[model samples]
Target: MPKSLWKIISRTFFFLLIPIILFAEVSGLSHSMMHKMELLVLQLGVIIFVAKGMSILFEKIKIPGVVGELTAGIIIGPYLLGGIPLPGFEHGFFGTYLALNPGATLPVSPELYGIATIASVLLLFMVGLETNFSLFLRLSATGVIVGIAGVIVSFLLGAWTGMLLLDLPFLHPETLFLGVISTATSVGITGRILTERRKMDTPEGVTILAAAVIDDVLGIVLLAVILGMIPVLNDSGQTVNWGYVLRLGAEAIGVWLLFTILGLVLSKRISNFLKIFKGINVPAIMAFGLALLLAGIFEKAGLAMIIGAYVMGLSLSKTDLNYVIQESLKSLYLFAVPVFFVVSGMMVDLSVFSSRTIIFLGLIYTLGAILAKILGCGIPLLFRKFNLLGALRVGFGMAPRAEVALIIAGIGLSTGLLSRDVFGMVIFMSMLTTVSTPPILDSLFKKEKMGTTEELLPAESVVTEFSLPTLETVEFVSAKSLQLFRDEGFFINQMEMGHKYYHIRKNDIFITMICKPNGIYFESSPDDTHYVKTLMYESFVELNEIINDLKDITKPESLKNDFMEGKDDKRVDLRRVLDPGCIRLNLRGSSKKEIIEELVDILDSQYQITDKKGVFEAVWEREQSFSTGMKNGLAIPHARTDNVGAITLAVGIHRKGVNFESLDGEPSRVFVLLLSPKHKTVPHIQILAHIAAVMSKEDAVRKILDCKTPQAVYQFLTESEG
Candidate 1:
């Protein structure tokens, strides 16, 4: 079928079926008909499926996936499609028991809400783990000022806007909740944009990130105080006890500060404690156990559970175990986090937006939130190192409010402080800021504008960078260095598996290693600068020794015999990649190197290789490590290199035979060269395995060598294999 036709059919099918699914009259499972567990399981499956689908669809159009997840919830919630009757359920799959409690704002069932609550905790914990504590400290002076200013301005403006528009008092819980929501800035969104633009290392970018971290911390503290105050005001019955309220606020702040300080001070000790488990996942699971325990403690102490989770994560952020826990819990994070966002979105009553007054209030609230960040964060920078342009860049970077804002809004609605209409307004403001800020921020960074007039100060840290020939070499060095560090009493954390990024620490020393396509980059404090250099020196020394051993063992006359007898059994069709233009029947070279070069030249002439020299160097280096010569008069010289954009092949037939260091101590007659993109492994291995299988057949090499023309060679290789 044609791709265009298939696409049209798929589109038409979905277009026609969507309405039926949305408004179907089939009976859905009632709480009495099925166990809550069964219903909850089915509901979760639907939520995850729709959430992931919407996320992918939205990402295709250049919007954030989080927005898509939110939309997924709104689409399928009790207020919309979720309210449609379905099979076994009078209410839809995602329907809530809100009919039992007409005042309930949350649309999901208690079990689903319980899961979303845990998801919120995990999400905030990750936020804290990702926060760079060292960078926060280094930029403390400016960051603290900018962050505090932004929070203060945003809070006041949001509260004022709520009061002016909603006719609420300044001290109303709804008004205060609005202020809390405004104080959040999603640096994750901003950081992604900066990294994509290659501006993450810039002064403005760094300042924005640092300030945003501060914003998160202060915002949480404010949330704690507000949460504490709400009870005091309610109990006082419009005659609040000023002294108790002040004391309650003080206690909240004190408890938060005390836990944070204690956590940071004992973080390394806690890391050591968890390491006692030693099991692959035990340590990560135990760490989460600590988070849960602290979350409960925080709730008991009259603060939000997420605040405790964040504090615990912030403390562990400096430990080498940070990445390990992050890596281990990633599956849980992916599964749980989306549920929280979707549930938050489900709480939005689309019915509330029908009122023009509510819509106008939401629009005005969003505008105020935008300008608040600009005036607050941007104005502070003008008095510091930044010019107006730089300040604006930083301000825009701090404007988006995503996960944290949603979390706060959810809390407000759950606590019954925010009505459905007001909650909708908060979500409306958050979505607008998050969706609008990135493009404006990206545009502001179009022309290069320095954040400072004076030359930026030299970094107080040291970086040992190694630009290896290929990503394979970088990985090789990384694995060796990790082992070496572990032996040296340093805990090693692979930042993200297969990403070639690592964080290693021991005692007072900490180091970060990043692997890019071009090189390995290591950053450390000046105090531990020698560790990176020493580690690399040792890795290269080991590499050299390995190379020397390879040179001794893989010589043409010294290699093992009977290699073809142990051929791979897997079969792959060579015709899909085989090209007649890349095959050469006659080759003038008499040496292994020369023969390989001749084959490479053919591929180059066919425009199959992008970087010829790079491909040559890779092939040569790989050959030096271990010869690719088979025992049955065949040589397959291959390299997975960035020099080729795809799977490329070249066939060269050397009639007189070349000394290609064959396994059976015989000269090689048939040379099959393969070069694949470095990032791909499966296809490279499959093709190599397939070639081995093909050649192991009766008289395969003889049949290939018998060809007189390039077309004959190509046809034989492709046809005989199939």
Candidate 2:
């Protein structure tokens, strides 16, 4: 232990000892009252200390902090701590003696259960606060399919396991709860591992997370139906009251239906209402209060508290208070969540080890947990054209079971649906799944090297837009081959010396281009399926465009009027626009905005335009919408507006490229800023094309870059073939 931690521990121990000594000396207090106070002190002092300490200890050993918290409760629990005699006290302070007394109900104070309940409620609320409801509707096809498959398979397997072991009837409460536990996985552990491996944003990792989220939603609905019907189990607990069970189930579903309606109807209202307390943290507090209210409503309506909490989160998911609630409620999550885990651990009686049946059932339950997730989640991925390796990775990623298991097992134990031995077995199954899944995932992923997909994205932030355009081969081989793709408006997310990657919006489809000395290579994501045909067609279209462009480059003189618009009788002369005074030689502006201002000034000063501000605003506004920077260090910033009397043009050169947020990753060295009256820039467009074509050539760009003054640049541009 650190010296600071040791000091704090020693002081905490001394202070707790003082409480006992002080309380014992008081003579007026009743025995039970004294015991209550003493126990409260023990819970506050010992429970919190041991829980936090053990969580730290367990975390160091690569086990989850929850495992350590639970182990701490077990060590100090009646099965271990209270099994031994203590000095002075009637029982050991570690636990209330219960198992030692036959036919005795649990002696644990109701206050402790109360705390655990609060922890559960808060934990669920935090989950709700963090969840993104819209994301469910936006999940890719593969994600949706995998999630449903995982749920269907796991739920069936779990129900089968329960029926096989217990001889339960169809739709039995015990059988259904087993299936519920298996269906809802805890993705946090696996998610963190993906983050460590830098694969969190990769196709496989992204699909697993999206699938997990989807299943959690589906699981909540399944669990609600099961819990609602549990009340209809008959006197013998074998047969169910069909009408009553159906009615109860309907009522549960109705509550959720009403919740959805209210959430949709009231989302904007909630956001507007939260704005009332804009300067204060009251919005977050009220958001939490709303979660509690929803939780209470769900509980009263026959669903679990967590279901209500999750619904409340979904309700506020579209609200602006989402991030505020998360940041503010983090302290509450940290303080209260570990208590629920530790208290749950304390509830696990080690006496289950004495029963061979419990051991056997626990092992079988674990087997069902692992195989169901693998077969269930993996098979769908493979069917959806995911590679075998990717299918296996996603399956294991969704396998760890912790949070949902504990919640369901607790519900079962509390409702008398499960016995102590069964509860212990369930908890063991939860721990087993969580502890064993990671190593298998690690081994599987380690053997096949992770792709460069993760490396292309920003590691620390959520990057929405690529900062620059894709870079291509010097021969423009990939550039020409990717022209049709570029026109389709895919985000050029990543680029290297000889490669580029493009992502289709709001979908899992990815395209990668690799340029080789011989030719170019093209491929799309999920290469195991027919999607490759789409990739091939796109590649074919771009190849044709590339061939046509090469043919045009060979016959450059034929392109002078190619990109022109409606013909004008008074078309402005291209050579006149390149006058010495109109060309800015080695312009010194540092940003796109600054360079634009300098170029616009040349046209304004030379032409004496009446509305310089209007012309600048029009040009700047167009640039702001999207970069006018063409590929290979050329930009044609043009605006057609009433602000300018005629089609006017100015050329500016920035040797040190101003990032116009250009498409090409290089600084734009050549600019063609055009300002025209409303409706016509036909001749101007033709001139802009000629400038772009000339800039595209190596010798032409070299001469422009080597220009000594504005006269030299003007001379070169005017003398050059249009």
Candidate 3:
């Protein structure tokens, strides 16, 4: 699996494989119409096997699988293995099918292009399926800033490179195409690195992910807007007209925004429609159907098909059925998506290297790609208080150019907007950037205190670590950001001024953020800590780039050995208190008292509440003291009494709202009554905090409110928040 070994094995295997394929085809050339379908099948089989082998080979060597597949296309295409002349092959047309159409080049076969189009759409569709729409509802400000900065910087750099190309022999608009390519961040490549390093859920990880997703959205939209000028440029000939181009760009942006927003608005209905097919295996078929339909519609409307496909994926991402659909389409995505990349690499004519100017332009473009991400991605992290190392990690992580970039380059090539040399430049730049990112990123992350926490594990427990800067150092960075007081989106939900734990405000028994000169430490009950650590680590990833940007800590330590240290333990769980056993659906209660009484009776009978009367009196007294309603149709009627031996929950949902003297002056339809010993207030408070967080997503609340069965509500509440 070593890189050198993998390279040798792969190169040797492909060297042998291609010659055999060439020999087979030369010996058996058939232009017969009857065997066309058979030929297509043969082509697909060869591509998939070769692509898969190259993909695995590259993956083992720590390169992205997609990059391998793309390279495979180059190796097998007319440029490399395809160049071999076989006996009688000069009179045959086997090479013609694999090449860019032998006799004629213009107006390439729709059948070939159509297959590529399907592959592209499926790739985007998978991209959409994996997208987390919920991230938008509670986006980290740092991520938004980073995403915006990257898009802007990369776009400018790409455009500048294109302008440079204009000074050479390239067309004016082709520079704009380069700019569009520069605007995107390849989410898959960097995301994979973070995941592999076990840093994907950290603050930097989450921020990078959210920012990457956002940038991708922006990138596609930019591609649409830039591509829209094709018709105008085509009609106006080669003359550069700024005014006309600007008008076309504006129109493209406007149209893209209109359709994108429209798609988002209609997403809920789309999810509902798709929900009917939840148990069926046809979701993949349905997903493809939707993607293709939307792609065609967008194409007809003068935008790119991939844009429509991406939007469709985003729309369906909101549904609970999202993962299921993705699973349904896994095989097709693996087999088909690689072809788009392979075919993209196939178009890179190796003969274009004769032009030194083009090669020099490619170098400039690569610089643009590299600097744009580091400056664009890192600057945001620095401002957000991430130290330089973390910023660099993210910057490098976002450095690679893959699917989206390839798609843009392909568009430019097909539209006749870019010369063959320019296309080669784009591919070369992509290949260089893609191949360079991993080691740089690996070193950056490894340079951080990314060792496992086994050395520091307390007692008979195990811990995990993959981070830079102590937890407190992160808190210090977060505190500085909060002090800036320039909020546009959600910041840390809890940060008591100058305190240890931020958002989970009360010094909870579950998890605590500690301030030590050495660094910030997170503590939890010895019996339970893994889930809490995971939650905190995810929050850190939400912090985005603090390690890369954080500075001026009041009390900071090297924290080389203390990040994420913990014992193997299970933390207190809200699910323990709020499960199906104590849950009621479609309650007939007409009043707050009625609902509470009925819920208490269920807890007393099924939940083993021995002192039922005493517990009821304690809870009812608390309810009378003040309405437990938190408004938005939710009420937490909680009480602490010795009568309750353990913390327990009784939840009821009434279709008809009950008047609970709510602060919002609305009837409450959902009630969660908590009963616990007076000493266990921390767990109660923690559960309340979780409930508050869950309710922040109005859709979560709506789903709970509409659940007709207790099991549905329970499932909705307990599923991983991620």
For each candidate in turn, the TM-score is 0.86, 0.58, 0.57
**lDDT agreement of model 3 with the native:** 0.68
Give the lowest summed-lDDT range of ten residues in model 3.
Answer: 560-569
Could you tell which candidate, 1 or 2, scores higher by lDDT? Answer: 1
Reference-based TM-score, model 1: 0.86
Better of 1 and 3 by TM-score: 1
- For model 1, the superposed segments whose C-alpha errors exceed 4 Å read 1-34, 99-103, 197-203, 231-239, 455-458, 465-471, 495-499, 516-519, 544-560, 568-570, 579-635, 643-671, 696-698, 704-722
The C-alpha lDDT values of all candidates are 0.82, 0.69, 0.68
Pairs clashing within candidate 2 = 469-663
**When superposed on Cα atoms, how far off is each prediction in RMSD?**
4.5, 20.1, 22.5
Clashes of 2: 1
Writing each residue's lDDT as its tens digit, candidate 2 over 557-607 gives: 233223222232233355655556788876788888888888878887887
Query: lDDT per residue, candidate 3, 1-722, as tens digits?
Result: 67776676667567545544555645655567755655455556666677778888888777778889888877766566654655534422225554446533312234545677789888887887777555443446767888889999998888887776656323346777888789777778877777667676555676777788768877877777666555555433465566876776676667667866877788757756765674556655876798899889878877788878887887776654565567678778887888777777777777787788778888888988999999998877766657777677778878888888888788877777777788889888888888888778877777655222122212332332324454445556445433331231111234333444432211112233444334545444565466545554555665665555565442222321121122212343567776588888767878877888888887877854778788888889878866677657777788877777778777788877888876668888878888778645457666655665555455655788877788887777776343
Candidate 1 per-residue lDDT over residues 1-722, each given as its tens digit:
45654565466446534534653554443456356787677678777767777777777677888888888888888888888766456665566476555666677788899999999889888888877787777677888899999999999998899889888788888888888889899977898789778787677877887898778877877888888777667632355678977887788888989999999999999999999997778888899889989989999998889889999999999887887888788889999999998988899889999999888999999999999999999998888878988899988999998888888888888878789999899888888887888889999888876767754545876888889876667778877878888889876667543456678877677888888867888888887767688878998899889889988877544433333554553366676677888888788998878887898899899999887788888899889978888867888999888778889789888888888877778889988998889765548877877776677778888988887888888877787654
lDDT of 2: 0.69
Candidate 2 structure, TM-score to reference: 0.58
